[model samples]
Target: MLKVQEIRELIKLIDQSSIDEFTYESDGTTVSMKKSNTAPQVVREAVINTPVQTTDTKLVKPEPVIEARKEVDMEKENQKTEQENTSISSYDHEIVSPMVGTFYSSPTPESDPFVSIGSNVQKDTIVCIVEAMKLFNEIEAEVSGEIVEILVDNGELVEYGQPLFRVKTK
Candidate 1:
């Protein structure tokens, strides 16, 4: 029988390597592991063939332990995302990029930015420009508010629907 520490080490080695399957049997104990192609995780099975005086025997599987750990990790990640979202006040609105492009704070490098943090704006006010396929598209504030935060920097690549700025709605 392999100790808990040995089994953990073997799992780490198998996860880091290209091996798809592995099996080990000794002293009536057998451990088998197979990697899932679709997901980067391993499926493991353990069987102990201990000789007992009773005729009844059953195979025990330890896969549930691994699955429970995965569930816990997912829950932690969800909590983290929730915390980030809650950091912004409910009265705040986010200005998002309409298309994939390079974000520009100003029309030209030498010109002043259209909007900045603490700057008040109206719904139709042009806050910035997003250049996609060589076409410069002026982005509006969308909501009347004071700029609370600028999420993206000048000349940075912005994705469609990605938040570019946070505004405190008036």
Candidate 2:
């Protein structure tokens, strides 16, 4: 049976490599780990080897492991559907997230939002906050414009360069 550290090392190895799934077994003991879009999915089975404890064939997963770091966007079909869902297209510009993080429209949940639809903003205007790894980062508009649409919901997860807002230039 692999020790805890050995299992962690195997998970790390799987995550770093392009392999989507990994499995290992020895002396009637088996373990497997897999990575998905949201989190690591581990399916564990009890192994009865030597003097080890008896177990059952079951799936056991640890706490949400760090997800594979990458940017995810709408698929071609989703883009088409969203475009059709849009009522109007005043999308002259976009305020995109600079990094992958959790987006917060307001400083705090109780506070008023930084900006809203039709809110006029300057190039340096703060539009939202993106928190990454416990670090809160203020996202700037970087373009003078009127906010035509809010692309992402408050507290929604965002990817690097993901569109957060659609703006119409002043």
Clashes of each: 0, 0
User: For residues 1-170, what per-residue lDDT tens digits would candidate 1 score against the true structure?
Assistant: 57767877777787679998888867645567667644333334443344334345554443322221121243576798896787576437899999999999999999999999899999999999999999999999999989988889999999999999988999
Tell me the lDDT of candidate 1. 0.78
Worst 10 residues of 2 by lDDT: 65-74
Measured by TM-score, how close is model 1 to the native structure?
Answer: 0.52
lDDT of 1 at 111: 100
**Which candidate wins on TM-score?**
1
In candidate 1, what residue range of length 10 has the lowest lDDT sum?
A: 63-72
| Model 2 lDDT at residue 58 | 52
Full-model lDDT for every candidate: 0.78, 0.79
lDDT (tens digit, per residue) of candidate 2 on 20-135:
87888775556777677755655556543334333775545433323222222326547777875673566678899999999999999999999999899999999999999999
Tell me the spans in candidate 1 whose CA falls farther than 4 Å from its real position.
1-86
